[model samples]
Target: MVEDEFATEPFEVAWAGEARWFLQFLSEGAGEVSVRTQVSADGLVWVDHESPALSGPMRGVMTVPVSDFGHWLRLVVTPSSGDPSSLARVYLALKE
Candidate 1:
Protein backbone atom coordinates (compact mmCIF):
# COMPACT_ATOMS: atom_id res chain seq x y z
CA MET A 1 0.00 0.00 0.00
CA VAL A 2 1.07 3.62 -0.43
CA GLU A 3 2.41 4.24 3.04
CA ASP A 4 3.17 7.89 2.72
CA GLU A 5 4.37 10.53 0.34
CA PHE A 6 7.80 10.93 1.89
CA ALA A 7 8.14 7.86 4.13
CA THR A 8 6.75 4.41 4.68
CA GLU A 9 4.79 3.32 7.71
CA PRO A 10 7.00 2.25 10.61
CA PHE A 11 7.32 -1.50 10.85
CA GLU A 12 8.66 -3.82 13.52
CA VAL A 13 11.21 -6.50 13.01
CA ALA A 14 9.93 -9.98 12.28
CA TRP A 15 12.43 -11.64 14.52
CA ALA A 16 11.82 -11.74 18.24
CA GLY A 17 15.25 -10.55 19.31
CA GLU A 18 18.14 -8.70 17.82
CA ALA A 19 18.63 -9.70 14.22
CA ARG A 20 19.96 -8.50 10.92
CA TRP A 21 17.67 -6.84 8.44
CA PHE A 22 17.64 -5.84 4.81
CA LEU A 23 15.49 -3.58 2.67
CA GLN A 24 14.84 -4.22 -0.97
CA PHE A 25 13.26 -1.82 -3.36
CA LEU A 26 11.96 -2.15 -6.90
CA SER A 27 11.02 0.95 -8.78
CA GLU A 28 10.29 2.10 -12.31
CA GLY A 29 9.90 5.68 -13.35
CA ALA A 30 11.61 8.66 -14.95
CA GLY A 31 13.88 11.37 -13.63
CA GLU A 32 15.96 11.11 -10.46
CA VAL A 33 14.73 9.17 -7.40
CA SER A 34 16.46 8.39 -4.13
CA VAL A 35 15.70 6.19 -1.15
CA ARG A 36 17.18 5.89 2.33
CA THR A 37 16.61 3.79 5.43
CA GLN A 38 15.67 5.16 8.79
CA VAL A 39 15.54 3.64 12.29
CA SER A 40 13.90 4.52 15.53
CA ALA A 41 13.99 3.16 19.05
CA ASP A 42 10.74 4.68 20.23
CA GLY A 43 9.11 5.14 16.87
CA LEU A 44 8.87 8.84 17.63
CA VAL A 45 12.39 9.94 16.77
CA TRP A 46 13.79 8.61 13.53
CA VAL A 47 17.27 8.92 12.10
CA ASP A 48 18.83 8.09 8.78
CA HIS A 49 20.85 4.90 8.90
CA GLU A 50 23.45 5.53 6.19
CA SER A 51 23.91 7.28 2.90
CA PRO A 52 21.36 7.10 0.15
CA ALA A 53 20.63 3.39 0.02
CA LEU A 54 19.47 3.75 -3.52
CA SER A 55 19.52 6.65 -5.93
CA GLY A 56 19.20 7.39 -9.62
CA PRO A 57 16.50 6.99 -12.22
CA MET A 58 14.44 4.37 -10.41
CA ARG A 59 14.17 1.48 -12.84
CA GLY A 60 15.73 -1.52 -11.07
CA VAL A 61 16.13 -3.38 -7.81
CA MET A 62 18.44 -2.36 -4.95
CA THR A 63 19.18 -3.98 -1.61
CA VAL A 64 20.66 -2.31 1.44
CA PRO A 65 21.75 -3.87 4.72
CA VAL A 66 20.58 -2.19 7.86
CA SER A 67 22.86 -2.15 10.90
CA ASP A 68 22.56 -0.52 14.28
CA PHE A 69 18.89 0.10 13.64
CA GLY A 70 16.66 0.23 16.66
CA HIS A 71 13.44 -1.78 16.96
CA TRP A 72 11.55 0.01 14.20
CA LEU A 73 12.42 0.77 10.60
CA ARG A 74 11.00 2.67 7.62
CA LEU A 75 11.92 3.94 4.20
CA VAL A 76 12.21 7.49 2.91
CA VAL A 77 11.93 8.17 -0.79
CA THR A 78 12.71 11.49 -2.39
CA PRO A 79 12.44 12.71 -5.92
CA SER A 80 15.26 15.04 -6.76
CA SER A 81 13.87 15.71 -10.22
CA GLY A 82 11.16 13.70 -11.82
CA ASP A 83 7.48 13.47 -12.57
CA PRO A 84 5.59 13.82 -9.32
CA SER A 85 3.45 10.91 -10.45
CA SER A 86 6.36 8.46 -10.30
CA LEU A 87 6.00 5.48 -7.97
CA ALA A 88 8.15 2.86 -6.26
CA ARG A 89 7.70 -0.43 -4.41
CA VAL A 90 9.53 -1.44 -1.25
CA TYR A 91 10.09 -4.72 0.56
CA LEU A 92 11.60 -5.50 3.95
CA ALA A 93 12.98 -8.74 5.32
CA LEU A 94 15.00 -10.03 8.25
CA LYS A 95 17.40 -12.88 9.07
CA GLU A 96 18.66 -14.20 12.35
Candidate 2:
Protein backbone atom coordinates (compact mmCIF):
# COMPACT_ATOMS: atom_id res chain seq x y z
CA MET A 1 0.00 0.00 0.00
CA VAL A 2 1.08 3.65 -0.49
CA GLU A 3 2.88 4.76 2.65
CA ASP A 4 2.74 8.54 2.31
CA GLU A 5 1.56 11.47 0.26
CA PHE A 6 3.60 13.17 -2.51
CA ALA A 7 6.16 10.75 -1.09
CA THR A 8 5.55 7.11 -0.34
CA GLU A 9 8.01 5.18 1.71
CA PRO A 10 8.30 1.92 3.58
CA PHE A 11 5.50 0.19 1.67
CA GLU A 12 4.74 -3.17 3.21
CA VAL A 13 3.50 -6.61 2.19
CA ALA A 14 3.26 -10.18 3.49
CA TRP A 15 2.96 -13.07 1.08
CA ALA A 16 1.29 -16.28 2.13
CA GLY A 17 2.55 -18.43 -0.72
CA GLU A 18 3.26 -17.43 -4.29
CA ALA A 19 2.15 -13.87 -4.92
CA ARG A 20 3.00 -10.74 -6.81
CA TRP A 21 2.85 -7.09 -5.87
CA PHE A 22 2.15 -4.30 -8.28
CA LEU A 23 1.76 -0.57 -7.86
CA GLN A 24 0.22 1.91 -10.27
CA PHE A 25 1.11 5.55 -9.84
CA LEU A 26 0.99 8.88 -11.65
CA SER A 27 2.52 12.32 -11.46
CA GLU A 28 1.06 15.73 -12.27
CA GLY A 29 2.18 19.27 -13.11
CA ALA A 30 5.05 18.63 -15.50
CA GLY A 31 7.93 17.13 -13.58
CA GLU A 32 10.12 14.08 -13.43
CA VAL A 33 8.76 10.92 -11.77
CA SER A 34 10.75 8.45 -9.74
CA VAL A 35 10.12 5.25 -7.75
CA ARG A 36 12.04 3.23 -5.20
CA THR A 37 11.42 -0.06 -3.44
CA GLN A 38 12.77 -1.82 -0.38
CA VAL A 39 12.47 -5.50 0.54
CA SER A 40 12.85 -7.35 3.79
CA ALA A 41 12.53 -10.83 5.21
CA ASP A 42 11.48 -9.22 8.44
CA GLY A 43 10.02 -5.72 8.54
CA LEU A 44 12.93 -4.51 10.63
CA VAL A 45 15.74 -4.92 8.09
CA TRP A 46 15.39 -3.53 4.57
CA VAL A 47 17.22 -3.85 1.25
CA ASP A 48 16.51 -0.96 -1.06
CA HIS A 49 16.41 -1.42 -4.81
CA GLU A 50 19.87 -0.57 -6.19
CA SER A 51 18.44 1.91 -8.69
CA PRO A 52 15.32 3.98 -9.08
CA ALA A 53 12.64 1.63 -10.43
CA LEU A 54 10.71 4.29 -12.31
CA SER A 55 11.45 7.78 -13.57
CA GLY A 56 10.85 10.31 -16.36
CA PRO A 57 7.96 12.47 -17.51
CA MET A 58 4.53 12.13 -15.95
CA ARG A 59 2.22 9.83 -17.83
CA GLY A 60 -0.61 7.34 -17.52
CA VAL A 61 -0.71 4.56 -14.97
CA MET A 62 2.81 3.30 -14.25
CA THR A 63 2.83 -0.29 -13.11
CA VAL A 64 5.74 -1.53 -10.99
CA PRO A 65 6.32 -5.20 -10.20
CA VAL A 66 7.81 -5.86 -6.84
CA SER A 67 10.28 -8.54 -5.83
CA ASP A 68 9.54 -12.26 -5.71
CA PHE A 69 7.16 -13.68 -3.14
CA GLY A 70 8.44 -13.30 0.39
CA HIS A 71 7.42 -12.72 3.95
CA TRP A 72 7.50 -8.94 3.93
CA LEU A 73 7.94 -6.08 1.44
CA ARG A 74 7.82 -2.33 1.25
CA LEU A 75 7.52 -0.06 -1.81
CA VAL A 76 8.15 3.63 -1.84
CA VAL A 77 8.01 6.59 -4.23
CA THR A 78 11.34 8.27 -3.68
CA PRO A 79 10.58 11.58 -5.41
CA SER A 80 8.03 13.66 -7.23
CA SER A 81 7.09 17.25 -8.11
CA GLY A 82 3.47 17.41 -7.14
CA ASP A 83 1.24 18.05 -4.19
CA PRO A 84 0.74 15.40 -1.56
CA SER A 85 -2.94 15.16 -2.42
CA SER A 86 -2.06 14.51 -6.01
CA LEU A 87 0.65 12.00 -5.18
CA ALA A 88 -1.69 10.21 -2.83
CA ARG A 89 -3.55 9.06 -5.89
CA VAL A 90 -1.64 5.82 -6.34
CA TYR A 91 -3.09 2.35 -7.02
CA LEU A 92 -1.85 -1.05 -5.89
CA ALA A 93 -2.49 -4.51 -7.31
CA LEU A 94 -1.72 -8.02 -6.06
CA LYS A 95 -2.19 -11.63 -7.19
CA GLU A 96 -2.11 -14.66 -4.96
Candidate 3:
Protein backbone atom coordinates (compact mmCIF):
# COMPACT_ATOMS: atom_id res chain seq x y z
CA MET A 1 0.00 0.00 0.00
CA VAL A 2 1.85 3.06 -1.25
CA GLU A 3 1.04 6.18 0.71
CA ASP A 4 2.46 9.25 -1.07
CA GLU A 5 5.16 7.81 -3.33
CA PHE A 6 7.53 10.56 -2.17
CA ALA A 7 6.97 9.77 1.48
CA THR A 8 5.92 6.20 2.27
CA GLU A 9 3.01 3.94 2.97
CA PRO A 10 1.97 4.26 6.58
CA PHE A 11 0.23 1.43 8.46
CA GLU A 12 -1.52 1.35 11.78
CA VAL A 13 -1.58 -1.62 14.11
CA ALA A 14 -3.93 -2.20 17.00
CA TRP A 15 -2.69 -4.49 19.70
CA ALA A 16 -4.90 -6.15 22.29
CA GLY A 17 -2.80 -4.88 25.13
CA GLU A 18 -0.15 -7.55 24.72
CA ALA A 19 3.55 -7.39 23.95
CA ARG A 20 4.28 -8.49 20.41
CA TRP A 21 6.84 -7.90 17.71
CA PHE A 22 5.40 -6.34 14.57
CA LEU A 23 6.93 -7.92 11.50
CA GLN A 24 6.71 -6.86 7.87
CA PHE A 25 8.32 -7.50 4.48
CA LEU A 26 10.79 -5.05 2.99
CA SER A 27 12.61 -4.65 -0.33
CA GLU A 28 15.93 -3.26 -1.46
CA GLY A 29 16.93 -0.65 -4.08
CA ALA A 30 13.85 1.33 -3.22
CA GLY A 31 16.28 4.25 -2.78
CA GLU A 32 17.69 5.97 0.24
CA VAL A 33 14.97 5.00 2.68
CA SER A 34 14.27 4.59 6.34
CA VAL A 35 11.61 2.88 8.45
CA ARG A 36 10.12 4.55 11.50
CA THR A 37 8.01 2.74 14.09
CA GLN A 38 5.99 4.99 16.33
CA VAL A 39 3.78 4.23 19.29
CA SER A 40 0.61 5.90 20.45
CA ALA A 41 -1.33 5.54 23.62
CA ASP A 42 -4.70 6.68 22.37
CA GLY A 43 -4.16 6.35 18.64
CA LEU A 44 -4.45 10.14 18.48
CA VAL A 45 -1.12 11.53 19.62
CA TRP A 46 2.03 9.76 18.39
CA VAL A 47 5.55 9.71 19.74
CA ASP A 48 8.27 9.23 17.14
CA HIS A 49 10.92 6.66 17.76
CA GLU A 50 14.30 7.84 18.84
CA SER A 51 15.71 6.17 15.73
CA PRO A 52 14.35 4.39 12.71
CA ALA A 53 13.76 0.70 13.25
CA LEU A 54 15.35 0.14 9.86
CA SER A 55 17.53 2.35 7.73
CA GLY A 56 19.92 2.39 4.79
CA PRO A 57 19.37 0.13 1.77
CA MET A 58 17.24 -2.84 2.63
CA ARG A 59 19.15 -6.10 2.58
CA GLY A 60 16.73 -8.73 3.80
CA VAL A 61 13.94 -9.07 6.34
CA MET A 62 13.68 -6.22 8.84
CA THR A 63 12.13 -6.83 12.25
CA VAL A 64 10.82 -4.28 14.77
CA PRO A 65 9.69 -5.40 18.18
CA VAL A 66 6.95 -3.64 20.10
CA SER A 67 8.11 -3.47 23.67
CA ASP A 68 4.52 -3.05 24.75
CA PHE A 69 1.13 -3.04 23.14
CA GLY A 70 0.30 0.27 21.55
CA HIS A 71 -3.01 1.72 20.59
CA TRP A 72 -1.48 2.52 17.22
CA LEU A 73 1.65 1.73 15.21
CA ARG A 74 2.89 3.28 12.00
CA LEU A 75 5.63 2.65 9.43
CA VAL A 76 7.08 5.18 6.99
CA VAL A 77 9.60 5.12 4.15
CA THR A 78 11.58 7.94 2.53
CA PRO A 79 12.29 7.78 -1.17
CA SER A 80 15.21 9.20 -3.01
CA SER A 81 13.28 9.58 -6.22
CA GLY A 82 11.40 12.78 -6.96
CA ASP A 83 8.61 10.77 -8.57
CA PRO A 84 6.29 9.07 -6.11
CA SER A 85 5.73 5.92 -8.15
CA SER A 86 9.44 5.34 -8.38
CA LEU A 87 9.52 5.27 -4.59
CA ALA A 88 6.49 3.03 -4.48
CA ARG A 89 8.45 0.19 -6.02
CA VAL A 90 9.26 -1.40 -2.69
CA TYR A 91 6.69 -3.49 -0.88
CA LEU A 92 5.94 -4.54 2.67
CA ALA A 93 3.79 -7.39 3.88
CA LEU A 94 2.42 -9.07 7.00
CA LYS A 95 3.65 -12.62 6.64
CA GLU A 96 1.60 -15.53 7.80
RMSD of each: 3.7, 4.5, 5.5
Error of 2 at 35 (Å): 0.7
RMSD of 3: 5.5
Q: How far is candidate 2 from the true structure (C-alpha RMSD, Å)?
A: 4.5
Best by TM-score: 1
Estimate the TM-score of every prediction: 0.71, 0.58, 0.48
Candidate 2 TM-score to native: 0.58
lDDT of 2 by residue, 1-96 (tens): 232323333445563433333434443434445665666766777776554577644545555665463556555654456432233355445556
- For 2-96, candidate 3 gives per-residue lDDT tens digits of 23523323445453443333223343344444556666677666677554456544334445544443456555554434332222233333321
Candidate with top lDDT is: 1
Off by over 4 Å in 1: 1-5, 14-27, 51-53
By lDDT, the candidates rank as: 1, 2, 3
Clashes of each: 0, 1, 0
* Model 2 residue 22 CA deviation in Å: 5.7
Q: Which portions of model 3 miss their true places by more than 4 Å? A: 1-30, 50-52, 80-96
Candidate 1 residue pairs that clash: none
